[model samples]
Target: MNSNLTVMKSFFLLGFPGLSPKYYRPVSALLFFFYLAIAVGNIFILTFVVCEKSLQKPTYLLFCHLALNDLTFGTLTLPKIISKYWFGDGFISFHGCFTQMFVVHYLGSVTSFMLLAMALDRFIAICFPLRYPVLVTNNTITVLCGFAWFIPLPLMLTIVLHTLTLPFCKSNVIAQCYCDHISITSQACGENINIVLVTALCIAMLCLLVPLAFILFSYIFICVVILKMSNATGRMRTFSTCTSQIFITCLFYLPRCFVYVSNTVGFSFSLDVRILIVLLYSLLPAAVNPIIYCFRTQYIKQHLIKKIKTSRFGIQLNLSFL
Candidate 1:
């Protein structure tokens, strides 16, 4: 350990270093906009699915799970960072930091598995159309989603527990918008820091790569099946159904993989640039997912339009009566 090492009871998040005080309100306003979009979009999806009995199928249920996960993630990380910029409060206790780290990682792992589950659902529907109804029921989807949320708990807990045992004597200044395993572990003071980094990297890659591999395979099979279709119109429609999911999958995985690979290859980004990349990859997908579903999914679009028209007609009727 270095001679300058000192115990750190709390961590300070230095969000966007060198940001002038004048920019604080502007930055907070921008982040609040993103959080609002994420909350409203996801909450709308959740509510719409619950209220629309026609959409209580396996596919929409899976969408609801994804929405719920995104909502939880945005709610978990964004509020504090928003408050920090808005109120000039950025200190976080040791345990609180680790707790945030755990949840961040756990939610990421859940999302990876959730994407895999969705891919599986699509794979079944596209490739085995006859068996899809029997094989991919609501109960089956519930089980898959439940497992996705549950399996990550123990693995992420192990990582967080191991990190908590390491002495954080180097510094408490986290150079990111929020606490994460890499950012937190980078502040540890010990000779075993490299080991911890490698372990964390391996675990993260395992969580990411495993589900990604499955998703890729599933999509490949779906594509092959689509190519074999006899009717061109059916082929185009089936392919269109998958475009939204493919877009979302790419959105979620590509940036994350780039960041991980860049870090592994020793490519360095400045603190502010790195945090911006993290925020974009982490939060952008959540904000955009509802929009994508609303526009791309035929059932959702139809139902949403109908609901809006009905509400408008009801208001018109009330005005006429008055």
Candidate 2:
């Protein structure tokens, strides 16, 4: 309903750099398949997490948040990209643009924060095993998750209001698939974009990177603690507890580090490369979070299989009743 009414002029999307239409089509075809994979994969992850009760621990609870954020991240960008390429309409309304900008960044920052929360969760479990139950209880995890979602609201509003205050006289083309802070700010008439830049950087650094650094330090401490243990079983247990977090933290931060550093300093990357990075960074986390969270834990896997078998039995029972 929202996308149909195009009030703006022609959209200006950043096309594939260094490639003509001849090359773009094939590339797009490839990307479309990846996009579909992202959607299906994230949906499966979310569903499995919800269906399997054994995944109700603090770790997988945080992972559900991760999966939810990843779903939003991919949904915000990919479908529009596919539609624009195939259907010849790339325009987005002012409100739609704002919605996209606000939501994507909000969820993105939240997921980053959630990962840090997860790392802390792991830290407590591994570093102070005796205190973990008391420290990271259900109530504590709930409160942390609540703060993770709410703390970034003000920052998101700052960006949103700044974009809305600017006058968009006639220009409506966005260089990227979805409306981001950079593209939206480009259209602002009198708003001091430097303010937006500063605010964005502050939020990004404070929210995304600070937690990431904490996670890194926590991991280092965890490693040191693991090594100090005389027993090999103790060391292996500690490391195993953190394996999922380590994988997830790397997947979440690496691309973000690249994009943030490159964009903040105005280091230009090829459009094709940018697109590729965006696609991978957005989708890979979604694809991996579920697999790592589910497969890494024995309880979850067994519960999942049990549930599937029960569902199959129920289906046969229902047919017999019919």
Choose the strongest candidate by lDDT. Answer: 1
Expressed as tens digits, the lDDT of each residue in 1-322 for candidate 2 is 2232244434455544455666555766765886676677667767876776656677777777777777777777776766656664567666877888898788878987898899899889888889998898767887899888998889898878865655565467676667778777776554455776777768767878788888889889888989999999878876887787788888888987888789989998776688668767766777677677667766667777887899999999999999
Candidate 1 — what's its lDDT? 0.91
State in Å the error of residue 58, model 2: 1.4
Q: Write one digit per residue (lDDT tens) for candidate 1, span 38-147.
A: 99999999999999999999989989999999999999999888888999989998788889899899999999999999999999898888999899999999999999
Instruction: Kindly report the root-mean-square deviation of model 2 from the true structure over all alpha carbons.
Output: 4.9
TM-score of 1: 0.96
Residue 76 error, candidate 2, Å = 2.7
Best by TM-score: 1
lDDT of each: 0.91, 0.75
What does the lDDT come to for candidate 2? 0.75
| List of clashing residue pairs for candidate 2 | 12-173, 14-175
- Stretches of model 1 off by over 4 angstroms after superposition: 1-6, 264-266
On the 0 to 100 scale, the lDDT of residue 77 in model 1 is: 93
